[model samples]
Target: MDLDLKGSKVAVTGGSRGIGKSIATLFAAEGCDVSICARGPETIEKTRAEIESHGVKSFGTALQGRDGEAVRTWTRDTCDAFGGLDVLVCSLSAGGGTNDERYWYRSFEIDLMSATRAVEEAYPHLKSSENAAILVVSSMAAAETFVSPMAYNSMKAALITWSKQLAEQFAPKGIRVNCLEPGPTMFPGSNWEMIKVARSRTYSGVLRQQPTRRMAEAEEIARSAVFLCSPAARWVTGATLRVDGGYTKGVQF
Candidate 1:
């Protein structure tokens, strides 16, 4: 599958590591120029180099996902740098926390607002592209009861609704919008990796729920994400694709 993504300009938030990094890397592998943003300067530079190593242009910025202005700036800068934008993948997240009102604000800013802000900023550029798409990286936790009540799950659920509505609104403009729900993906420095060590029982419980008895890898989720945003999936929009490796129990239909 060529993906027909050569020369496409793509942007991904939180792309320095974990699933975001994988998504950017895969896009670069498919010959798309990629721009990424993350809070850590070193990680951002490193990931940029890795993406560029695949022979496509790579741009990166060091900034917090919750910073709306910074996100919009990155979106504009990416379009300027690459001439235009073809795909936007909102992959930044604040992770999970419970009981604290501050956690709610943090998750809202990082997870939900980041996607909304990026899409708002990227909309004009996306509308100019021949094939434009947006992929919001959510979690299976959004659709299923995976853990205790927390802001992360709720905010992700909000994204699913937003993605659907955006899909409908942008359809006439030729821009597709979709969401992806990944479950218990494990990678170096990922929250799941820490939970596996510090909260072994909780990690074990999640793994046991998967029929595969193992968590998904960041690349596994990235592959599905790239396909959704590619020309190959031009007809896929307003759809929430769950790439959870059977960790989610509810029937999607």
Candidate 2:
């Protein structure tokens, strides 16, 4: 089915690999002009090539996704390349791990503030579009932490709150906003070491908790994100959609 996203200009963060790459690919396939950003030059180029292969106008850049100034600069460059931004997908976030207070601050910068900056930078452009939308990619941990990383849990929870307030503020400006909470998705180059640790912590239990009995694919999460940002979900805003495999319900009992 048509997502009605043709000619839309989109900006995606952390788009070099994993879920970000998946989202960029899906958006390109839907005929959107997509620009992606990540820290690694090699991965950025690779993902850019992949998306451009779909016959969509695509660009990718390597930059620090957490820095506010950097995010603004990247957004300006991307907007210039894409003409204008109609869909903003904040997909950048720090992965598993814990360090000292310095690390905690870094996580906040990368996970929470980065998303805020992206939205802030894209706001004007989004406001210009007739059916503008912003899809903030969060995690199930925002609602149900379970065995997720502590820093991730904290930042994502905050992200949900921020998205709600932003939604309320932007809806009146013709810009819709929503959050997407993706379950554990299996993606290439994923940090398997962390997954191994989580799995070994409670293998059978975690597996059983997921109704699907397996982790999600990157495309699965991307599909939900694309839907939330499309005109199909025009009325969806100031809300969070959980794309988990029923793990949330399983955790209740």
Residue 122 CA displacement from its true place in model 2, Å: 1.1
* Clashes found in each candidate (C-alpha, N, C closer than 3 A): 0, 0
Candidate 2 lDDT over 42-95, as tens digits, reads 988888888888888887778886678988888888888877889999989887
TM-score of each: 0.98, 0.93
Model 2 weakest 10-residue run by lDDT: 191-200
The weakest ten consecutive residues by lDDT in model 1 span 244-253
Residue 247 lDDT in model 2? 68
Which regions in candidate 2 have their CA more than 4 angstroms from the true location?
A: 192-194, 197-199, 202-205, 250-253
Model-by-model lDDT, in order?
Answer: 0.93, 0.83
- Each prediction's RMSD over C-alphas, in Å, is 0.7, 2.3
* Candidate 1: tens digits of C-alpha lDDT, residues 1-253: 8799999999999999999999999999999999999999999999999999999999999998888999989988988999989999999999988848999999999999988999998999999999999999999999977679899899999999999999999999999999999988889999988888989999998878889998889999999999999999999999999998887778866
Among these predicted structures, which one has the highest TM-score? 1
